[model samples]
Target: DNIRLSIFVPIRDGLCNWKLQMVCKTDNIPDKERTAVFELNEGVLGYTFLKTRKHQIEFIDVSNNNNLPSTYVSLNSDNSNLINRDIKGVLVVSAFQNGSVAGLLAIDTENVSDLSKMEDNKLHSDALDWIIARSKAVKWIWRIKNNV
Candidate 1:
């Protein structure tokens, strides 16, 4: 799929920090702050993607779900370090695989009437699907490399 996955490296804080240098190469679909870096502290988007370690799509409010990691919540609150530079109506999805996050697919839009609106969007869906598919491909490549 030739997905342009942004590679993040873990920092001394034990948090996976986004590499600023790589952000420029990203597509930034739907348009957003060019200088913004993802903040995963008490934010739910970070909690879901980084803590739960699964695929997730989150809207503006970061604390709607009770399953969000307590640690993530305490560290990054809904009002603290907002995603996409505190944009009001942001739709974000994280694609993590093989126990590590490869990249995030996001879009800046008005209040979406339905979550499906984000998922059904061709640009958004393709980015997410491509990330997942690419992650799987990485696993297979690694397995073959190790002859496992």
Candidate 2:
């Protein structure tokens, strides 16, 4: 089992202020078939996460977190129902560097207990640091390719 790390950058397209353009993901998918992009609407999880620009965790229990927009509650795919049966929720974290948000990292877990236990563990910190570093690298690559 592998965790998927998605890198999103804010792009403007007329009225869309904070449109999250998916630059890359750690998942092994064909380039021509990847379409995991979304807009960071106000009060949604992506907006909230991007605003904080800090490492945080979210237990995405759609049944309980109705306040979260449908788009914010799921990450497995554009379709929320595609969530894995064993995935009780997801633990998402973000990275920021050079005074700007870089990207988001998410991991699927079997239950809340698994994620809760990771809060203060060394493994969690190490993994988070690695993910942040990778995200920064991906952002750099994206900027170079797009001449941003």
Candidate 3:
């Protein structure tokens, strides 16, 4: 048995609209019952809330430039509204073109009861390094593509 990994990428232009692209891979895991990992590398320029619904509203955003942090909104409430909650177990990585990155690494909702606790400078620093490494790898791949 193997664990599956899901990668979601949303691309957008200048408007606050996005199209989702998903990729799933299952060849990297040796154990099946461990845990599935989902990595979100988002370069969101801005986001707009669409409709004034109580639960499960749409978020329109152009994810070309990294300007906003990737967030996790819970949709399980008594009122059936999608409100921000302390449900952990999601990682968000935001990478900017100017060589900067921000992320929410470990989201322990039980310990972190509020949004303010999720904002940590150390996590941002680690995310920056991860983004930089990825940027370099992308550039190398692009060069290879050009050579071919």
How many steric clashes between backbone atoms does each model show? 4, 0, 3
What stretches of model 1 exceed 4 Å from their correct place?
1-32, 42-44, 61-86, 111-116, 119-127, 134-148
- Model 2, TM vs. native: 0.58
* Best of the two (2, 3) by lDDT: 2
Residue 125 of model 3, lDDT score: 59
> For candidate 2, lDDT tens digit of each residue in 35-102?
44455642234644645546654435432455454555344344233323455445556666666655
Q: Compared to the true structure, candidate 3 yields what TM-score? A: 0.31
- Which RMSD values do the candidates have, in order? 8.1, 4.9, 12.3
User: Would you list the C-alpha lDDT of every candidate in the order shown?
Assistant: 0.42, 0.52, 0.29
The positional error of residue 92 in candidate 2, measured at the CA in angstroms, is 1.9
Best by lDDT: 2
- Give the winner by TM-score: 1 or 2: 2
Q: What is the TM-score of each candidate against the true structure?
A: 0.43, 0.58, 0.31
lDDT of 1 by residue, 1-148 (tens): 1122232222222344332111323463222333333355434345445543466555443223453334644423433343333233335556555655544544444333443444456756665676577665544433443344
Clashing residue pairs, backbone N/CA/C < 3 A, model 2: none
Clash-forming residue pairs, model 3: 54-81, 55-81, 55-82
